[model samples]
Target: MQYLFRLSAIYVRHRRLALAFFCLLQAQAAVAGDLFHTDNADLYSRAFAVVPAAISGDTQLKFGDTPPNLRLRNSLIIGTGAALVAVYGSNNWWQSGFGGGFDTTNEGWFGSGTKFGGADKLGHAYINYAGVRLLTPLFESAGNNRDDSLSLALWSSLGIYTAVEVVDGFSHNWKFSPQDAIANVSGAVLGVALETHPGLDAMFDFRIDYRRSPRSPKFDPFGDYSAQKYLFVVKADGFASLRENSFLRYFEIAAGYGTGGYDTGGNHQRSTYAGLSLNLSRLLADDAYGGHMHATAFQRGTDRLFDLVQFPTIGYARRSLD
Candidate 1:
């Protein structure tokens, strides 16, 4: 009874921000392509048509009398690591062995190691930015409130960047970048700012390139295959929080895909996918504390359509502000 009440209070407190965030994401996602192909009105028209339906669906799912509950059983689950302890506990270990001391000496992008120069730094930033944008819901729970969500965004981005830096700093093969870490946090905050602020919303479109071959084949996994395809994809993806009731997690999924093909397909393909995701935290226990499974079917140029299942790990929190 006490636990249920506490959860309810959390949900009610952060309800508006959570929903606003979700709706803004859906709206942004629906029209994301417009920012790229400023010339294509028809493509954007179709995307705009889907926004109301998406918002309506979100509302109905929440208002439904019986909510979905597919969380993993108790025996399978364990709570997250003790928050404060995790930060302090791992400090000494990282500093001593990982050469974790900050370097005021190494300056500029890729200055410590390989130099594709600025492009390499940009490519790495893209992934970190995308990762943060996609994983917002898990860390920014409505149950915690708006300030919590914002805090989560800032801290989680920092934490992830720090963890990655620590690993790279200590690893025998790689050099750590305080610069890369700064870029990631900057991009994440920029992404969140784009979503929340009206005047700057349109500034969300930016591309970072990942080079092949002469750039660094060893680190590039796509180099394994004989086919080297340059894919130009316009993607808008997000996770939304379901209302707190009987369910653990629920999110609407939608994506528009336009890839410049290298083959005989006239160098283009237009695709759209829509589906629902189920959070599987209760099932997997360890791997899925706040994780989810996305099931989507995509249509590609008449006959080339397919379905996919992606289970993304829940993002770690950026804040310790309990």
Candidate 2:
């Protein structure tokens, strides 16, 4: 009961922080527009139009518009905001017991112990993927070339993850994991690859889902894995050759992996699942309001809310307990 209460408090706090972050982004966008003397109406319109344009391959949907200064401005704003959150919002993981001196030891691939059954590693990858994809467009809007923006997004994501590891190296509770770093790099690479390839980007998405686990020791959402799963969803529209099949065009296939019983040595469980999902965004792309809502809602947030909320149509799971 105490753990549940603390977990709820942390969740609420994080939600508030997320809301504030969104507000900050909106404010930054407005300020950038004012500095460039760009009409606000045009900015908002273009923001809304970019989604459809990007999907339709319209020439007007160039990935850049603002000047270099604006790009730097937005980058600095976001970086600083993220740094603040990491330092302060991390429940003093950075400050508590800071005198441990950096240890150069490698914490094996599986994170010392199976505390979260490697779910945290998957969380890291998904976060890096989403971070790079989300920031790439912002960089482009700030007048960066598409390729350049992708590169920036990649490095920035990796850099942030690396910074966390560096901090962990100095902490007593956590040690650096090479596996986590690899996951971060892999995710960043995937994000860049998908962003550069329109067909693949449209066809596939990386997503994550979690449910509260009674077995979690602490209230830490990042570390809890009793009921967390990472997913790869294949969009139906990716099959351009099968466009005639309307039924197939509205459906997606998903594969997911998760683990449980990390805290128990011999009771660890590994699970894999295959499922069907609805392609909501593609299904509603023709509706102006729906398209705009889908694009804005998914793009502007770090979490892929739509994917997290959508339940799988039919799922089959296989589990192995060791």
Candidate 3:
């Protein structure tokens, strides 16, 4: 009974925070107007028009048939509340790494000698950032406005991830990592900011690529730190000026970091890299490839996929920083 009550309380508290902040964002959004395309009369402004917002980098928004007779406040409350419930379940997920009591550990950040060579930190960030983007679509599909959906995604992500850290504070194997907390905040903020400003979102993508080392120990895919790389990608297609340049539109620039020989292998080293990369998303959306004036579902999927996973075959490594 006590355990159930505690679990219930967790959801209740976070829901309150979700509601409070969502209400505040609702006000701000009212002033800001529609978040995606500036002009509703634009071709893509129609519901799920399957058209990308030119070079602005706004993803396909499902501007739903939410009835105008319905008050925006009530719609927002119902929509955001449903999303929070789905993401923030009423259960104590803290049973893992079950420590009898509270504990602590000092895990340094990004040092060659540190655990997994800071891969876990980047992992934390990536998951949070991805979570926000992924969750926003659910609200959008449910007829929630872009502003409410995005704000809910942001607040729910932080509240849920932070709750995990708090639970770690009480566990035995893992102590709460302040560094992980900071990364969570950073990623969540980046996700919301990019969604807000499509131009900036156009120029950058945070991604992970994996190429297993020959000597790597056979650990689980995620724990196989030797095989993972984190990247930031800048796409030329994001610039309207480059769109007409047949060759340059698909060009990209990438920089990334990785670690080798860790996770039970010998001789660990940190690797940094720079490279020329292809914009697979733009390639699919191009007219020469039977694409249209705007992005299609297939093209949109490619863009979202590349946001997290970098396809190594399409990218060229210029040099490495050992």
Question: How high is each candidate's TM-score?
Answer: 0.35, 0.68, 0.66
lDDT, residue 170, candidate 1: 49
lDDT of 3 by residue, 1-322 (tens): 9999999877666664454344334433432234332233432335343543363434433345443222343335434544453333222222232436656567888987787788878877876787677767655654557886787677656765665565566644467788888888888988888888888878788887877666654533444677788788888877889867989988888888877767655777787878777887777666455745235555555568877688864554534334
Q: Determine which window of 10 residues in candidate 1 has minimal summed lDDT.
A: 70-79
From the highest TM-score down, the ranking of the candidates is 2, 3, 1
- Runs in model 3 deviating more than 4 A are 1-97, 212-221, 287-294, 316-322
* Error at 105, model 1, angstroms: 6.7
Q: Candidate 1's error at 180, in angstroms? A: 1.8
Whole-model Cα lDDT of every candidate shown, in order: 0.34, 0.62, 0.64
lDDT per residue for candidate 2 within 1-322, as digits (tens), equals 9999999877766754554344334433422333333233444335434333244444344534444244344557456646564645355443333336766554444443555656777877887888788777776666666766676666667766776766567666677777778888888888878878977877788876666677655565455666677888887777876544867877888888878777433367777778787776655564444434235644434223454334544455665534
lDDT of 2 at 134: 75
Better of 1 and 2 by lDDT: 2
Q: Model 3: C-alpha RMSD to truth?
A: 10.5
lDDT (10s digit) by residue, model 1, range 68-177: 12111100111121122233223322222233443332437532222332333443454455444433444333232344344444454455455545455543334667
Model 3 TM-score relative to the real fold: 0.66
Candidate 1 has an lDDT of 0.34
